[model samples]
Structures are given as structure tokens and as C-alpha cells.
Target: MKERHTSLLMFGLIASIALFFMLNLVLGSVEIPVRAVIRVLLGEEENTIWRNIILKSRLPQSLTAIMAGAGLAVSGLMMQTVFRNPLAGPSVLGISSGASLGVAFVILLSGSIGGVALSQLGFIGEVTLTLSAIAGSLLIMILIAYVSQKVRGNVSLLIMGVMIGYIATAIIGVLKFFSAEEDIRAYVIWGLGSFARVSGGQTTVFVVIMLVVLPFSFLLTKTLNLLLLGDSYARNLGLNIKRARLLVISCAGILVAIVTAYCGPIVFLGLAVPHICRGLFHTSNHAVLLPASLCAGASLALLCNLIARMPGFEGALPVNSVTALVGAPVVMWVLFNKRKSER
Candidate 1:
């Protein structure tokens, strides 16, 4: 009966997500009618501008919202499970900051160097930016992991992650101080967090990266389940805790980095979506939680994207702002409730 209920909830969430996606297609800056959008997509009408807006602008933006939502949510769940911190998330743990720093360097520093466009750096720049971001995130993850092993307190590790994030942000501020106006302006625009920045070709790259990381995360479900049983119990169950941790971190890192690169920093979907799913489904089991979070995240993201196009709002709210509004309240409620219950 419970299984059937979960299936029904998932179906309902997915249906809502699909409905919102079509709505996004219909409503935008220009407010194309739904019938016109369908006609444009079908190539039944010869409106080039409408066709371009639908195909080039709205479609990619909506697709970006889906991938970013799913990636960040899953990454958050993995980190939360690994660190055993409800607050553990890509943004909170300094991972997203690391990616932001990498992007800032390419956009700000490189651009200031007379004639060095990041695009001129080509595949090399892409590799460098991606690798540097990954390295920065891994450094923080490893530090937190080590602290978790040494300190014997979850709060301390979480605080340490917060400190790491601040440190990264401070470094970024220093970089900004020395950057030229034009480069700084470019970086600031990117920092506002839009789903419209990623091109169609880049979407293919993100999809491939996600596909690779998703399987590893899925395969680790058995280990993850045993993990929630505590280290000693997991060891007794023949799961190598170290290997499990490594795989989880690696998968989460890749997904987080990819989303950050493509969509800028998406805040809170990761931290909030998993908790929402847990409450709705009443299970910590990764099998159900993973898929449930995916649907919920996608649905919420599409909803937010739709709301972002609010009537008379200037140029849509930044994606991060929308997510933060949703995620922050959930975090506060969880913490306060947990504290009260503990008392």
C-alpha cells in the first residue's frame, strides 16, 4: 500500500512538472499564447522571431531549470547523508563558491589581461575552469571529512564548512577589488544566476556529465542504506566506509560542478528538496528518496521559473533568489523543530 502511494505521489509530481514546463513555454517576456507556441513549434506558422524565442530562449531556459534542480537536489542529499548534516549542501559547503571563484577568474582576471578572452582559451579554458572548481570543492569536502573523523561532533564539521565558504567568498572579494570594471561587470551579471546563459551545445555536455554521475550515485544506494545504520554497523555489514564515502563525494562533486558551470549558483534546492521528500514519503531510504527528490525538485524549479516571469517585474528574479526564498524557511523550520524536540 505504501509503495503504491509513493508511486502515485511521484506520478502526480511529474504531471505537475510537465504542466509547468508547458506553461513556461507559453508565458515569458513576450507572453506568447499557448496555441501560438504550439503552432510555432510545429513550424505551421512563419513567425521567425516567435520561433527563435520559443526554441532558442524559453526551451533552453526551462531545460536548464530541470537539470540544475535535479543535480543540486541529489548532490545535497548525498552530502547530507555522507556528513549526516541536515544543512549540508553544495552552496553551504563552499562547493558552489569554488565554482563561482573559477568562473570569476575566467571572466574577470583573464578578460582583464589585454586580449585574453576565455573563449580564446577555448577547450583549455573550459578544462581549467572546471578542474579548478572541482579541486576547490574537493578540498573543502576532504577538510570536512577529516574534521568529522577527528572532532566527533556534527555541528563542528558543519561550522567548519561554513567557515570554508566564507573564506572562499573573501578570496573572491579580493579578486573583485583588483579586477577591471568591464570584467567585474561581466562577472557580476553571471553571478545573478540565470538559466538562460547555457547554450544548446553546452546542454549536451551537462546531460552527458549528469548521466555519468547519476549511475554511480544510484549504485551506491546499498552502501548508503547501510551507512545510516552507523559506521560500525555498516562495517559489520561488509560495506567499506571509506570507499563508500569516496564514491559519494565524487559523484556529488561532479554533479554540483556541472550545474554550477552551466546555470551559475543554484541555492537551496539541494538542502530543501530532500527534506521535503523525506517528510512527504516518510522514509530516508535512498531508493525512494532519490527519485522522489528528483521529481519534486524539477517541479519546484519549473514553478519558480514560471514565477520568475512575474508581470511587471524587471527582467526576472535571479534563480538563486527564488530558491533561497523557498529553501530558507524550510531550513529554519527544520532546525527549530529539531531543537525543540531534542529539548
Candidate 2:
């Protein structure tokens, strides 16, 4: 019965993901016909402009949203499970804040601190941004893993992670104040987050990186299952707790860094989707939960991307804004339903 229920839920989520994905492709600023989109996708179309719009713009953006949503959702599930905290997430671990700080260093301090203006750097400037974000996030994740080894208590480690995030944010604020308005504005948009920023060659690279790393997380399912039985029992079962924690965190951090590097710091989907999956599937099993969260996150992101670009909003809405507006309600619904079930 449990397996049957999980299968049904997974099928539903898969269908929703497909629906939202199609909606995103068909409902952008220029509403391309579904038939045209299908034809364009299959290389059976002659309309160059429509084909270009679908392939160059909307398709890449949709693909980006899918990867961003799936990667962050998986990262959040890892953080929450590792910390055993309901509220723990990718940002809670200081990963995204670290990425922001890295970006701040590049954008705000490019001329003054680095003695190299970003604009003059050209293509190298973009490379610098991605590298900086990855380096900063990796450094923080390494610190957290080290702290996890020494802290003993999950809550203490969690608290330390939060403190680390705050410190990173404070640093960024000071940089923003001293920086020029243009740089600050750029940073602000990056912080607002968007699925439309990545494209073409960059999109291929981004999606490939996610595809490679995401599967590695699934391999840890047996290990993760062991973890749910508590530390003592997991230890008894021959789980190398510290190594497992470090590996899991490293995976989560990389996912966040890559997504944030391209899409900015998208909010809520990561933190919310895992909870929603749990509520829907009624199981803690990583085998089912991970795939369900991936699908749910993808569906939610595509839905948000579609809404953000809707004609009513004139496509002016930020992905972050849409995610928060749409996601918060879903999160609340999940919590309320969970509580009601418990009651």
C-alpha cells in the first residue's frame, strides 16, 4: 500500500512538472503557439523568429528554472536532514550569503580592491564572478563541515551556520554602502534572482554540472536512511558520521553555488519543496523523497517562472518575488496540513 501510494504521488508530480514546463514555453511575453513550440523543438519549423525566441530565450530559461529548482531542493533536503532541523536550508548554512559576498568583492571592490575594473575585464569578468561565487561557497561549506566535526550537537552546528551567514551578509552590506551606485544596482538585480539570466552555451554547462552532481546524492540514500535512526544507531551501523556529513554538505554547497552563480539567490523553493514532498508522500525514505522533491521543485519553479513572465505582470516580476509570493502560501498550507494530521 505504501509503495503504491508513493508511485501514484510520483506520477502526479511528474505530470505537473511536464504541464508547468509546457506552460512556461508557451506563455512568455510573446505567446508562442503550443504547436509552433512543439515543431520548433523538433526542428520542423520554418519561422526563424519564433524558432529563435523559443530556442534562444524561453527554452534555456525554462531549462535553467528546472535545474535551479531541482538542485536547490536537493541541497535543502540534505541540509535539513543533516541538521535534523525543520527550518534548516541552503541559505541557513551561509552558502548563498558566501556567494553574495564573493560577488560583492568582484562588483563592489573591482576597481578599488582588485585594481581591475570589471567592465574592462570583459569575458574574464563573467568567469571571475562564477569562480568567486564557487570559491566563497566552498570555503564556507568547508568551515561548516569542520565545525560539524567539533560541535557534537546538531543545534550548535546549526546555530554556528546561521551566525556565519549573518557575518557574510554584514560584510556584503558594508561593501554595498561604499561601492558606486552602478555596481550596487547590478548587485541588487543579481540578488533579486532570475531564471532568464543564463543562456545557450552557459545554460548547457550549468545543466550538465547539475546533472553530474545530482545523481551522486542518490547514491547516499542508504547512508541517509541510516542517519534517520539517530547518530548513535547510525554509528553502530558503521556509518562514518563525519565523512558522511562532509560529503553531503559538500554536495549541497556546490549545488547552491552553481545555481546562485547563474540564477542569483532564488528563495523558498528549496526550503519549502522538501517539506511539501514529505507532507504529500507521508514518508521519510530518501529513495522516494529525493525524487519527489526534485519533481515538486521543478514544477514549482516552472510555475513561478511562468507566473513571473505573465502578461498581467508584463514579465517585470523577479523570480525571487514570484517564488516568495507563490511559495510562502504553499509552505503555510503544508505546515497547516501537517499540524492537522498530527492533531
Candidate 3:
């Protein structure tokens, strides 16, 4: 009976993702008809204007939301399980902050030091921002990976990651203070987060990177389940605790890094999606929780994306804002239910 229920829930999540994705394409600010959206997606639409909007804008945004959501959700689940803390998340490791710091240097320092604001450079600016974010995140990930090997304790490693985040944030703050007003404004906008940021060929690359990396997470599911059993127990059961920790952390870090690089530190989805999945499925088993988080993340992201771009808003709302509005309540419900159960 439980297996059947789980299967049904998974199916529903996939269906929701599909529905929300279609809604995103069809119900944007321009109000493209459902039929027209479908025709455009099928390469049958003859209207070049609608074709450009659908093909060049909405399609990439929808795909980015799906991939980014799935990647972050899975990363959060891994971090929570590895650290054995429900509050643990992708940002806890400071990978997102590292990406932010990189962007800060580009957007905040460029005008002050180089006498030219990269933010106004258009395509070149966007490309530079993306690359800098990737470089910064990978650098931090490498540092964390090194620390993981030496620390031998998840608590200590987690603390170090937090400290790294603080340091990065401090640097960003200093840069912001010295930056020009226009540069600061640009940085703030990037920090607000947007799915529409990754458009055109960049979206394709982001999707491909996620497709290649996300499956590697599933490979660690068994390792994650074993880690959940506690280190001593898992070790006695033939698991190499240290190696497994490194693998899980590396996987989670990479996901957070890439997602933050492209989407600009999207909040709440990573921290909330795993908990939502656990509450729905009522299981600690990663086997179910991992896939559940993936689909649920994608679905929720699509829903958030849809809401952000709804008619009245004209897509002015940041993706992060919608995610917090949606995610906070879900998290509150999870906590409330947990507390009641304890009672």
C-alpha cells in the first residue's frame, strides 16, 4: 500500500511539473494562447513575434527553472542527510556565497578599479558574471573538499563552511561600499535572483550541466542512506565514512555552485523542498526522498516561475521572492506538524 502511494505521489509530481511548465510558457505577460504556445514549441507557429517570445524567452526560462530546482533540491537533501541536520542546506556550505562573492568582484569592483562598469557591457558582462561565479564557487568547493578530508567530523566541517560564507559575505560588503551607485544597483538586482537570467545558449549549457551532474547524485543514494545510520554504525556496516562524506559534500557543493552561478543564489527551494518531500512521503529513506525531492523541486520552481511572471506582475517579481512566499509556508506547516507529532 505504501509503495503504491509513493508511486502515485511521484506520478503526481511529474504531472504537476508538466502542467506548471506548460502554464509558464502559455500564461506569461504577453498572454500567448495555449494552442499557440504548443504550436510554437512544435515549430509549427508562423508568427515570428510569438515564435521569438516563446522560443527565445519562455522556453529557456521554463527549462532553467526545472533544472535549477531539481539540482538545488537534491543538493539540499544530500547535505541534510550527510550532516544529519534537517536545517542543513546547500547554502550552509557557503558555496552560494562564494558564487555571490565572485559576482560582487565583477559587478562591484569593475567600476571602481577598472573605470568601466561591466554590468553595462551587455552580453560580455553576463558571460563574465557567469564565469566568475563558476570560478569562485569551484574554488570554495575545492577548499571545502580539502577541509572535509582533514576534519573527520561533519560538525567541524559544517562550521568551517559557515565561516567561509561569512568571510565571503564580508568581502562582498566591503566591495559594495566602495562600488559606484550603478554597480551596486546592478549587484543588488543580480542578488534578487531570476530564472530569466539564463536565456539563449546559456540556458542550454546550464541544462546540460545539470543533466550530467544530477544523475551522479542518485549514484550516492545508497551512500547517503548508510550515512544516515550514523558514522559508527555505517562504518561497522562496511561504509567508509570519510570517503562517503567527501563524495556527498562534493556532489552537493557542485550542485549549489552551478545553480547559484546561473540563477543567482535562489533561496528557499533547496532548504524547503527536501522537508516537503519527507512530509509527503513520510519516509527517511533516500531511495524515495531523493527522486521525490527532484520532482517536487521542479514542480514548485515551475509554480513559482509561473507566479513571478503572472499577468499583473508582468514578470517584474524576482524568482527568489516568489519562492520565499511559497516555501516559507510549506516549511512552517512541516514544522507545525512535526511539533504536533512530538506532542
Ranking by lDDT: 3, 2, 1
The prediction achieving the highest TM-score against the true structure is: 3
**Residue range 144-181, candidate 1, lDDT tens digits:** 55655566444665677678788888988988898877
Task: Estimate the lDDT of model 3.
Answer: 0.92
Backbone clash numbers for all candidates listed:
0, 0, 0
Scored by Cα lDDT, where does model 1 land?
0.76
What is the C-alpha local distance difference test score of each model? 0.76, 0.87, 0.92
RMSD of 2: 1.6
Which candidate model has the greater TM-score, 1 or 3? 3
TM-score of each: 0.85, 0.95, 0.97
Per-residue error for 90 in candidate 2, Å, reads: 0.7
* TM-score of candidate 3 against the unseen true structure: 0.97
Model 1 residue 274 CA deviation (Å) reads 0.5
**Residue 291 Cα positional deviation in candidate 1, in Å, after optimal superposition:** 0.5
